[model samples]
Target: MTDYVSTTPGLFPLPDWAKEDLSDLKGHQKGDLIGGDEDGEIAAAYEEARGEVIDRQREAGIDRIAEGQLRWDDMLAHPLAVHDAVETRGIVRYYDNNNFYREPVVSGDLDFSGDVASELEAASDRVEEGLQAVLPGPYSLADLATDEHYGDEAEFLAAIADFLAGEAEAFPDHETLFLLEPSLVESPPEDGEDERASEAIDEVASATDSEVVVQPYWGALEEKVYAHLLDADVDAVGFDFVSDREDNVYNLQEYGAPGSISLGLADGQNTLVEEPETIRERVEWIDDQLPVSAFETVYLTTNTETFYLPYAKFEAKLEALGEAAELAEVKAA
Candidate 1:
């Protein structure tokens, strides 16, 4: 018998109540609240919305729950863009997606203000257990940002890593911490750069007692990059099975994954959700191909953030994943 778990992305489509609240205000943006935010109404709205999503995850029989990143305009760049040390510049395209986020230009050294930790704290108050925190991986954050503070490339990467490490240290107790690193695929590291990226990830991993999952999406990483990721000390590494399954499978077969690996079986970008049986079959097939003990824990997860999808579709996809994981476990037993 195999052990599996189902988890969705941190960024999700806003709930109707939260949407209504935001729209009622004239100057409201993603995180900006309407009505002048005098009484922290928008902040409260995010918490209430987070509670609604937590309930949705429970209703769908999902395992770990997230706070939905409702306050974040974009998961990767929003924290830095809002941080005091960085200045928000023009919006930049998020990877190859149609969505864009305000770019954070680094003009000074980074200061960790427990921004992510505060999100987890709010989420912890809502859910009793199995809470997961997701954040932008150091490499991806650095890659996406405009760094003018550190002249040397390695210095910049290290500074970003240390900054994120501070953020991880302050996080409340949680089940899992997902570090999303889409830049590994968007701006694949140059020769010998993957190792440095891995080091940066490890720096963050070391700060948390919770299992840290380094997930690179949009596409499979290059073979060498994948190897470096596997060697990293994180508890697990994740792959995007939706976009380029063939290349991902080849990497897993060629290099063999670590003891714990996450599989992005659901397509987050699309509106159509697959049947449970189809997802079950895909999981079983991949499991059979991996070497014995290749994975002790396989996380069935979203290929990317579900912020692009409608709320109903996102909930349906989560329901399917929970059912699919159960089916696969039963079949393996």
Candidate 2:
């Protein structure tokens, strides 16, 4: 029988203690002229900062931990460590205009010159054990990319998907699972846009061997989107149960294919903690319709990224979550 596993939404902000070093590195990576310290010093600080967050996660009893993304210059830059041609500096947003992301598209080819293996390895070592390395999905990348980048959007999407597939497969054995976050899934297109976007997503899902997860938060998934996912050959699908309505759960039960689901029970983006019994009750309700065995695992997580909250909030939220889990255990007893 497959064992149940748990995880959380990716990304954590740098703590105030580590802010200066993190900002220095960010400025250096972005080619900004910030006078503070040497790159080597900042690098050492980053390793320490990353370790601190990982330790906090372990203390919280989180099964899988991320390096709190302290090592990343930016969210997109995180993947740059693995793929080189895709320069973090290459991704420039057109912030002055409303169509900011519509800036000219850079090359979509795979660049593996700066493999993230070393960074991931270092992160693994710092955590005192192994943990899943997170990356954004190709579909989200393509959608988030500027239209100026390509003559053909479909072609670009396909190529990006292939590139991600290669990166996902190259990680060391310590990371048995890789998370491809497609946060853009929350913003469904008007009409024709949806079909084009779905095809791009299909390509990425087909490329990886690891358990591919499609996660959308802050909104409910549409029927067509759910149908598309049900047919995809992926390992699991994650939904924001904390934000999704009763109808959303009903739709999932009726249309979602029999597979593992990572349940987003806690609010990672906030300081408010949830009662584990409340979460258990929700899981039990879902279990009544779908056999427990149908799921490979039902992970509890925050609806969105936890880093958006402050460190104190994050700790408080974790404390609440720990209480909830304990309550669930007592009730189970």
Question: Could you estimate the TM-score for every candidate?
Answer: 0.95, 0.78
Estimate, for each residue in 1-333, the C-alpha lDDT of model 2 and write its tens digit.
334444565677666677765565565332232222237877787678778777777777666676565544434334532343442334354222211121224454554432445556677776655476666666566555543344576667666666666665565544334354444445555455556555655565555445556666666767776675556566666777777756457767788653677767777765666665676676666666664446655555676667557777776555555555444445444
Q: Provide the global lDDT of candidate 1 against the true structure.
A: 0.82
Tens-digit per-residue lDDT, 1-333, candidate 1: 346888976788898667778666434555342111224666777778888998999888888888787777755786687777887877677788778777788889888868778888988988788899888998899998888888888889999999999998998899999999999998988876889998999999999998888889999999888888877788888888888888988998898776788888899989999898988888867766774235788888889989888888988998999898788778767
Candidate 1: residue 143 Cα off by (Å): 0.9
- Highest TM-score: which candidate? 1
The 10 consecutive residues of candidate 1 with the worst lDDT sum are 30-39
Q: Go through the candidates in order and give each one's C-alpha lDDT.
A: 0.82, 0.57
Error of 1 at 79 (Å): 1.8
| TM-score of candidate 1 relative to the true fold | 0.95
